[model samples]
Target chain A: MSLKKEGPDPKDWSGYTVGLNFGMSAIVGMLFGLWADSAFGTKPWGVLIGLFMGMVAGFRVMWQATMSNTEELGEKNQTENEAKKTDKTDV
Target chain B: MSLDPLHQFEIHKVYDLSLMGYDISLTNQSIWMLGTSLVLCLLMMVGSLKTAKVPSRMQGFVEVTIDFIQSMVKDTAGKEGLKLLPFVATVFLFIAALNLVGMIPGSFTSTSSLYINGALALTVFVLVWIIGLFKHGFKFFGMFCPAGTPILMMPLIVPLEIISFFARPATLTVRLAANMVAGHVLLKIFAFFCIAMGAFFAVPFIPLLAITALEIFVALLQAYIFTILTCVYLNDALHLH
Candidate 1:
């Protein structure tokens, strides 16, 4: 997460946006469906499908965020191990 | 006296300019936007006229502002995004100006309305899609499916990815517009309370001053967040990872 040793963490903001995107996706999907219902007179079915789709969209944001964080953790660990090995060699 | 805190949001048309049955009259919001752009342009143009190896105070301010946005873009979107520095900087300045100006009494905030922010977000939405398509050609469609997925799971993953992609602009729009509106409304309400308390106005005035100070910080933070978020979206388009 510390791409730079100096500045504040970038992941801090992105982590907050993860949950925000989930809420936004659900709202956007439901509103889109609501607009469609008004336009085409398809009330319940449109919403039903929209709800499922929105939920899936929200889950995707969470899943991708978690996956990326885990990947970063793995890389960080590898880098630390390599650093340790180099320190031992120097000693 | 009943004070209407939300009254500032009401747009009053200064001049009517209807062409092709479309109302394009200049409103309060448009005036503020134009004013913000003009002032910033003048500052940047005049401020940078005398370029120095070591910038003067004015030049330093302008240069630092540009550098800040440039660094944010480079950080999030990589070296390729440095090319988009001007556009990203313009957006940051534009939104920052609007937010700051709206803090002034009798100033209209262009960003408070979803009509404005929604359009801005939509433009980014279109821009990102266009950039992705132009860069990746037919392969841009693959963005809907994450890399290294099992073939059988593609069916479930693709639709979710598409929906999430579709939600990006909405999230951007909601975040900016909602923040501006909420801050302004809260400020107005507090100010009203402060004023209405004729005898004990000092008590409310203290909090009002604090909120005003906080709003300034918020203005800066929101601009940084918005710019960084834009860079992130651009990164997704460029890298699809």
Candidate 2:
């Protein structure tokens, strides 16, 4: 039952933040697309493009964040291993 | 007799003032924000005013909170993130204070409004944008591409990345504001049930108590989530990841 709080853990990042990003992007895209459709009278095509763009952005954010977290965890593990090796040498 | 759950959110002008073509009058929401911030500052300052080898409960609480925010910044933004600690700490404390105060019956919840949330979110949005550009110069655009993005796919990927960038503040604004509104509305409904049932109102009262406790947890959680996300975005600004 350790009460100590550590620096950012990959596990600490919740799916909700990611979901917030994805869901909002979709909404932003759809609404903006609709606005553009009316402005340009492009109607269906404008909205379709906007929705597609939003989905692309939303997925990309999730993908990029996951990729970066993986890289960060790998680096953290490498550092821990190195430190452990130094402790062994000292012992 | 009445259960208008959203009635709590209404703004009433205490001293209605029309300045030429503009309306700038004092409202309950404004007072709540001001009072919450003043009390928060006074307490945080007074709690740690005395330094001793043995800390009192107030001092201990203040120190722990400071440490928590400091570590959050360090963890999310790395070493350079320490520069934003004061700002991050202030934001967390202010929001948390408004939330706790709001829980007191009839007190206004300033943090529940989208206008307040939007302003705070936009400030973070602008601040991080400026910080990233200042720190990395033109290379700040590299944040959008991430690593290993092929040059040929830049056109398609770049726009998606840009849209995602815009989503940052929008999500931040929505998460906090929406949570507060939903929780308070539910609490109001349960409370209305508790009182309206009279002799049999105990059943509804129990759930109301539970919801009130849950609302408190949410207030703290929302503050924390908002602060940590700020740190994460600041990290992105500093490190371009």
- What TM-score does the predicted chain A of each candidate obtain versus native chain A? 0.77, 0.77
Query: Which CAPRI category fits model 2?
Result: acceptable
Task: Provide the TM-score for each candidate, comma-separated.
Answer: 0.87, 0.85
Give the worst 10-residue stretch by lDDT in candidate 2 chain B. Answer: B1-10
**Tens digit of per-residue lDDT, candidate 1, span B1-241:** 3377678789899988999999999887788899899998998998799999988988888877777676678778889988878878888898898888888878888888888878878887888989899999989898887789999998888767777888888877878887888888888888888777899999889888898899888887787788787888888788866
Candidate 2 C-alpha lDDT tens digits along A1-91: 1124775553357445787888988877887789899999998987898888998889877886777777877998999999999999999
> Which parts of model 1 are misplaced by more than 4 Å?
A1-10, A31-43, A66-91
Who wins the TM-score comparison?
1
TM-score of chain B of each: 0.95, 0.94
Candidate 1 on A1-91: residue-level lDDT in tens?
1223333345646666787788877876777778778889999877777767788889777876788777888999999999999999999
Q: Which ten residues in a row have the lowest lDDT in candidate 1 chain A?
A: A1-10
* Candidate 2 chain A, run of 10 with poorest lDDT: A1-10
Docking quality (DockQ) of candidate 2: 0.41
Lowest summed-lDDT stretch of 10 residues in model 1 chain B?
B1-10
lDDT of 2 by residue, B1-241 (tens): 3468888998888877678989878798987888788888888888889977798888888888888888878777888989989989988998888888888989888888988999998989998989988999999988878688889998888778777888888999999999999999999998888778899999999988899999999999899889888887887888875
The CA lDDT at B59 in model 2 is: 82
